[model samples]
Target: MELPPGWSALLEDYVAHLDAERGLSPHTVRAYRGDLVELARHCGVGPAEVTLPALRSWLSAMTDAGAASSTVQRRVACVRGFFGWARREGLVAEDPAARLTAPRRRRHLPRVPSRADVDLSLASVSARLSEGDNPLVHRDLALVEVLYSSGLRVSEACSLRLRDVDRERRALTVLGKGGKERTVPLGVPALRALDAWLHRRPEVAGPRSPETVFLGARGGAMDPRVARRVVHAATAGAGRGAETGPHGLRHAMATHLIDGGADLRSVQEMLGHSSVATTQIYTHVTSERLRQAFRQAHPRA
Candidate 1:
């Protein structure tokens, strides 16, 4: 198979490992590849020429190029990954990018939509498919249902296998960060949507015996990018504005649950978050809502 432009042969090897050995979702593997390709283009050299100072210089160039801190950090990680792969394959005696560090990004609160906003978004998605213009309607609707209902990432939403979804229990096993798998409940909306999608999934999936729950127009795996586009269009079509993305829906899911008096830990498990600390961030949002309510209702004004 051909590698990404400017990708080192070692990167190609590591990417294979990430897929076959690590069970990393294709989306993540692509991200790592994209970052590495950018690094390779900057270094102007092949795998054997990578060095610590050169890596640092690339980081400096990224900073100068006005890359976001988060993006820059990802680039650094990709460079480090290349070195790690090189050492593992015995191409290098020691990893030169070992001591390199990704830049720190200022933490900002995640964006979560209100109930009205989520309703509009979901309704819009549903409305589009009901029109019959797109045969992938069931697939799109099912994806939206699972995403909003279970709070899955876009990658997880699309990668779901048919067997992973348990019809009797209305639950599915989600493979999340670090290849961790967790069983999450699906609501009636998700179940119904999934049922409808299964009815029409074969139409879009041409001729493959794909066990995947969702498929693209070509009968293969749906790209997360396409999932994102569908979501953006649906949300915009419903007049919810175009500010939010799929993960924003995840933020909305966690926040809505908290707003409905659900425990933070329970929210963490639902989102498949590894850290309670990560889930704790939503508490801040709820607290803000409380303050807003208090200020609005109190006579102190």
Candidate 2:
């Protein structure tokens, strides 16, 4: 759908701001753009002409069309972000979306693989790579190990450079969301996997290769998609049925850490969450597990 002229130009600038200044990933920028465009089309007016009523109507239309609560919430966020930027940049006199509200999103507990399941997956990947001197196998093993061991986001892991890993400290310097930097410790297994991969990396590194720690078959930086595929394949090979990905490994790491007595603040730092509240979701997981165990063990009715 063609957006109004003023809205179209404003959206382009907002998207650029989000990419260059906000440091959001391209996928996120695209989602924001999509949401804003749909809102602009629904409003049938330019940015300067938008009103709170129009915004409410757009949201109402979305709900009437059966958009999910999450979808509606994201669209509300997109509207708020666009207008907030426009007001600050002088494209709009006032932020019309300032008071706009979205329905509260239901907090769904993240699915975490059991510790035994994670171990089984890693063992399966190790066995598969044991028979071969293939660089790809080594890279996959290292990718999964680092993902589970340090709770690194898949994008952060894919974007890692050779200098980011400190062998002496057994830690990685990760550039996480909003351009924040943090150091997370690596486990012994992760260190060994990384060492194996690094030794074989020279075979795959070419003249055009970047300084990225992990390389693809074409001798360039590994993409997040490749990392996700590695996780899915590894999990499936381990005989697990539920859908698993790199983020699932991250959740499992955090859950397991809490279960094993890691403190909340430390887990927050390790996971790169901006707030400890964001890291508290794992506590819910542990509490639920405790409740389940109680139900199973208690004999009295």
Candidate 3:
């Protein structure tokens, strides 16, 4: 297949920049680079020739090739980033790729459990509190509380160590995606759950986990998938829809914060989103729901 001249080398440099400077994981860097490879083939020109028309044509070709909307959209974003980087580094004079837009993706909103539903889920865990018996209840409760309260990713929750919790500050330190670290606040319930679980965790941790916060029957770092499965099973029994997972709890945390008037920028930072636009999806969620409610109840059309 025909490929752009020197495009291969430039792509290597850009991918390296993404890895070393941006701290993107090798896997993520590779994913972004895959699209660039296709771009080189499509454009049939070097990085210097990335005019808007060529960019648009590449996207159109992706559409013709029957790429999924999400895939096409991500490739478009990668192209924009590449061109922006190129222009800023003087590889190009003006960013002709600036005006490019990704294919429109079907919009989806984060699912937030309602107030009554939230009470039911939390209360269900509390009510199922093993009454003086089962050892894993405390760990389970702590997991749910921390997930809903802090909106932590499953990996972050599983990665917790003994030293990461600051009891005095009511904060839990998390190593988020891309190896970024952030401090997440611990709510009262989460703290209490953590304390109780720490007590029982010593009993339940199998032989594996030595220092992680939530441990299995053999005392070791809890497996993330198991944590998710526990969340899935527990949420299913809580009467919420089956769609409720640990991520649903995370979404709930973001929505609860927004409804409580937390600024979008703060939530974006707390969630480790790179763009305010990514976080803005919650605004759309809240606004659309409000619109639906208003239209249904309002006296006027």
Candidate 4:
């Protein structure tokens, strides 16, 4: 269904607001635009004409169409935010999505690699680098080490700049979701890897390369997809049940921190999570691991 012209204009304005005023990341702005566009198309209504029933019906259709609960939940948040902004901007007389709700999302525990397994993987990567001085291998090793050490989201890692690294402090200034910036400390291993990569970076760096800390083969800013592939390949043979990727490495770092008795608030700060509740999931992962170990090694029921 084609969205009305008014609806299109309203969506564009809201997108601009999200980007320029709210300082949301491009990915987040795109997601908000997608959700609102789908809502407009589904309801055949402009922003001002949208009603609560229309909002609910849109969400109901998404559920009926087999969207994941988490996806629907995200859309619900998108709609509520858009409508709230619209109402404040006088684009609508009232907010229709204010009362909207979606199904609760299932809290699935993240897969976390053991420290030993992760060490084995990094050692393997180091072995590959020993075969010859490959810049790509250097970059990959540094990328994985940074992710595992700092618990940075893939986007934040890719967005990192040369200025973000403070070698003396052993910390990186990371820009995370919603443009929130925080300092995450690097482990000694990560700092070593990063030092190695920086030494080789000049060989691959193009003339116009940005100040991004990590770079692609062509010297452009590091692509998250490339970073993901690098991580997956590095960890592919780590021999854990769950396949590890950049995000899995992130989960692993957080889980390891919690396992080592780092406070939830500190992990939350390190991870740049907006809420301690988000950081608490690592505690769940650690607890489940203990349960599995107890079941395996206990002598009596």
Best-fitting candidate, measured by TM-score? 4
Q: Which candidate, 2 or 4, would have the higher TM-score against the true structure?
A: 4
TM-score of each candidate?
0.77, 0.94, 0.75, 0.95
Ranking by TM-score: 4, 2, 1, 3
**Residue 21's lDDT in candidate 1:** 82
CA displacement after TM-score superposition, residue 280 of candidate 3 (Å): 2.7
Q: Tens-digit lDDT track for model 4 on 37-142?
A: 8888888867888888988888888888999999999999999999999899988898988888779899988776788889988998999987987898999999
Stretches off by above 4 angstroms in model 4 are 299-301
Could you tell which candidate, 1 or 2, scores higher by lDDT?
2
Between candidates 1 and 3, name the one with more favorable TM-score: 1
| lDDT of the structure predicted as candidate 1 | 0.80
Candidate 2 lDDT by residue in tens digits, 96-125? 999999998877677677888889888988
RMSD of each: 4.3, 1.8, 4.2, 1.5
Query: How much lDDT does candidate 4 score?
Result: 0.89
Q: 175-208, model 3: which lDDT tens digit per residue? A: 8778888887889988998898888776776555
Position 76, candidate 1: lDDT: 76
Better of 2 and 3 by lDDT: 2
